[model samples]
Target: MKVQLLVSKWCPVCPQAERIWTEAAQKVPMDLEVLDVAERNGREVVSRLRIKTVPAVVVDGTLKTVGVQPLGEVLKLLGA
Candidate 1:
């Protein structure tokens, strides 16, 4: 599965989200892309998904959840 983490450098909680997802990626067999909203690819995702917040999680091209998810929750989301 594909996991896209939509984040912004300015968002306070984004770093934590990134950490969780990065660790989760190491444990799962999925493609994990960390996208910054200020960048081109991230902007496209944000626009396409109508996402208005940072630390958003997208699984297999669908918006799964928003904000900073715990490690266990993230693993569950990834079906790990």
Candidate 2:
């Protein structure tokens, strides 16, 4: 599975989101990419998905959820 995490450096909760997903990725067999909203790739995703919040999770090109999800929830999302 392809997992894309949309985040920003200034977002306080983004780091937490990153940590959860990063740890999940290490345990699961999936592709994980962290994208900054200010970057071109992240902007494309935000525009396409109409995402209005930071710490968004895109699983296989589909917007799964937003905000800092719990580690268990993130693992579940990854189907781990």
The digit string of per-residue lDDT tens for model 2 on 1-80 reads: 99999999999999989998889988898899999999999999999999999999998989999999888988887777
Q: What is the lDDT of candidate 2?
A: 0.92
Q: Which stretches of candidate 2 lie over 4 Å from their true place?
A: none
Give the alpha-carbon lDDT of every model: 0.92, 0.92
Worst 10 residues of 1 by lDDT: 71-80
Question: Could you tell me the lDDT of residue 38 within candidate 1?
Answer: 99
Model 1 CA deviation exceeding 4 Å by range: none
lDDT per residue for candidate 1 within 6-57, as digits (tens), equals 9998999999999999999889988999999999999999999999998999
